[model samples]
Target: MPLKLYLLPILTLFIMTFSSCSKKDSGSAVKPTEEGLKVSLTNVTEASYTAAAGSTYTFQAAVTSKLPSSGVNITVKAVTDPGGVNIPQNAVAPSTSGAIAITLIGLEPLRTVLVTVVITSTSNPDNTITKTFWITNKAE
Candidate 1:
């Protein structure tokens, strides 16, 4: 028999062995939960800022969740990229039945403010979700 005939059979066996080992080493994959938790920014209203060079403003955010009846705990924060904004220190933990309100104070004029609401499940502390909203001051 020619060397080419022996070469083909040896190559075929080598390929099959490598493929089978790869599949087994990959291990079992976990499917994501279809009915897992989710969070949404319900409302952002009563937002106003002063036109003066130095002034104060108040902003509010409403957060809601679709967790179980027991509800999920969340931490809502107001963040700004430009800086010099005051977000409340207290963190809110909203219930499933009702939404939570977060207040931000002392925002500067002609600046953009980014508000972020982060929701974390008390049941699963490792799981966390976040949503953001942008507010721009009207030109004076």
Candidate 2:
């Protein structure tokens, strides 16, 4: 066989391998324009909270988003007693000042509940954040 014939096949294979391995500009692809929601508890300074048993504990939170939101959805769950916590409102419109009220009443005394609060931005439901805290009912 001629040397040029062998070189031609090898050169073709080398060129094909290098061309397929070339870097691609994947960064230029279009991405979804979604922003995350920000939630902050304004009244609760600590991660955990305590309140008198049989009394309603009211707290304020601030939620903001860069994009316009239809409203905010607040879901609360009591790890200790699912039926013990009472929520007056779960869905609320976005506040201009980004302030919302979260009220909870502990029905049992000397009981601790692990409260999970999930705040979801209606504009982008996927962009949600969760806040988990413990709440204890104390004797009045």
Query: TM-scores across all candidates?
Result: 0.48, 0.58
- For model 2, residues 26-123, the per-residue Cα lDDT tens digits are 78856465667778776554467655455455677676556334666777666564445543334434544467787765435666666667877666
C-alpha lDDT values of all predictions:
0.55, 0.65
Error of 1 at 101 (Å): 2.8
Worst lDDT run of 10 residues, candidate 1, spans 45-54
Clashes of each: 0, 0
Q: What are the per-residue Cα lDDT tens digits for candidate 1 across 77-139?
A: 555557746555465545564455555554556676666656666556556666666665554
Q: After superposition, how far is residue 78 of candidate 1 from its true place, in Å?
A: 2.5
